[model samples]
Target: MNNIENIRPLISVIMPAYNAENYIEDAINSVLSQSYEEWELIIIDDCSSDKTLKIAEKLSNNDSRLKLIKNSKNIGVSETRNKAINLALGEWIAFLDSDDLWENAKLEKQIAHANKVGASFVFTGSSYINKEGKPFKGVFEVPESVDFNKLKRQNVIPCSSVLVRKECFETIRMERDNMHEDYAAWLRILKSGILAFGVNEPLLVYRLSVSSKSGNKFKTIGMNYRVFRSIEMNPVSSVYFAGVNLVNSLKKYNKILFKNKKIKRLRLTNPL
Candidate 1:
């Protein structure tokens, strides 16, 4: 029989929280309840003025696996995540937003699949949840495997749903500090010729709150426009692909508007 402890690699789960007092407990509990026991939860408090720090400290006091890191000042999410990455001591790094919760088997399933395929980065599907904790019917479809070319067309990898090998970070440093840091980081990784594998299962509950920056569709579109502009400036394959993605992004924005309209109608009729 394999020695479970010896064979299991330590996975570092990093959470960058700012004013997440309402949902941080659920996030912490989700990590603690993971079937993969050999993992550490690192919660970095990004100088939240709310009770987020107090809640994190309370949880850390109860569980030895949970750690609390308070930043001296409020930095953006990118800087907070990079700080957590620098402090991580595990072979693999997993990220969870303060408002997101993982399925109980998320880490176990992802780690197993990563080991099986020898993949450097693994991402899984996620179910969108509203602020009330109700799961939405709408789903995001991510490809099973992503190459450098495919990633250029669209960024299907969800930040909260991704688990990346520590070594991948060594080659492609996460330096993007824009509003769309996740997209920039993924682009950098793909540019370095690293491929990411995806598990089609919805292993995470992605919270969609009005308070979240990503919930602002217009801001996302503007940031994406900037991403394409940066990529177009690159000498290789810019002229063709950048134009393609620009059109695709326009279509995507239209679809999002349509969906929002339907959702609004449903809310009016159903009164929820």
Candidate 2:
């Protein structure tokens, strides 16, 4: 029998919360409802002025598996996640954002898929939900696998959908808060020839809100440029990749708009 079949490994879930009072409870409860129970959720509140810490405290008090850590000052998401990761004890590390949710079987399915395919890092496809929790028209599916170069074009890995071996962080820690830190880390690991596997199902529920930094695609252009530079790619190369990133981003948004328009037309033609 494979070693995976014989072992029930513990998964450490990292959640960095900052002024997430509106959605933190549902995020915590999603982990609480996971089919796979061998996990510990570490919620690190990045010194929010809101009730994020208080809400996490209340939930943590009820379950030993829930651990709440408070920061003395407000830090960015990358550092906040690094703090939780350092305190994590599990062999595997999974990231769940304060405002996103997982399907009940997300962990169970992703873990199994990773073990069966011998992938150290795994991410899942996600379906979109608005601030009020209403579903978007379609799911975002990821390719079965992607390497370092493939990911450089566009980032398909959603932070909330990541489940990776903890040891992968021995040489990789999220840095450069100005850019996508998670993307930087993944690129570094994949640069060392590690291939990431994707579970092409909507195992994650991503909340779309204007308040999020990524909500405004045009605003992230400079941030994406910094991502290539952080990886030490030359100025000319970085510019090219940044342009590629912008084009791909536009393509993704166009798809979303097309779907929405199609839905409106269908309603108009087939209304009861």
1-272 per-residue lDDT for model 1 (tens digits) = 53542368999999999998889999999998999999888899999999999999988999888879999998878889888898899999999988888999999988888877878899987666777787666555567899878877766777888899887777555544553567667777877888899998889788764343334444445555556555444544454454565566556434434655544422100000
Q: Which lDDT value does model 2 have at 132? A: 77
- lDDT, candidate 2, equals 0.84
Scored by lDDT, the top model is 2
C-alpha TM-scores of all predictions: 0.84, 0.92
lDDT of each: 0.75, 0.84
TM-score of 1: 0.84
Summed backbone clashes in each candidate are 0, 0
List model 2 lDDT by residue over 1-272, tens digit each.
87767677999999999999999999999999999999999999998999998999999999999998988988888999999989999999999989899999999998899888988999999887777787777777899999999999988888899999999998789996777788888888899899999999999988764343343454466677787898899988888887787787566655655766633211100000
Off by over 4 Å in 2: 1-3, 211-218, 262-272
Clashes of 2: 0
Candidate 1 pairs with clashing backbones: none
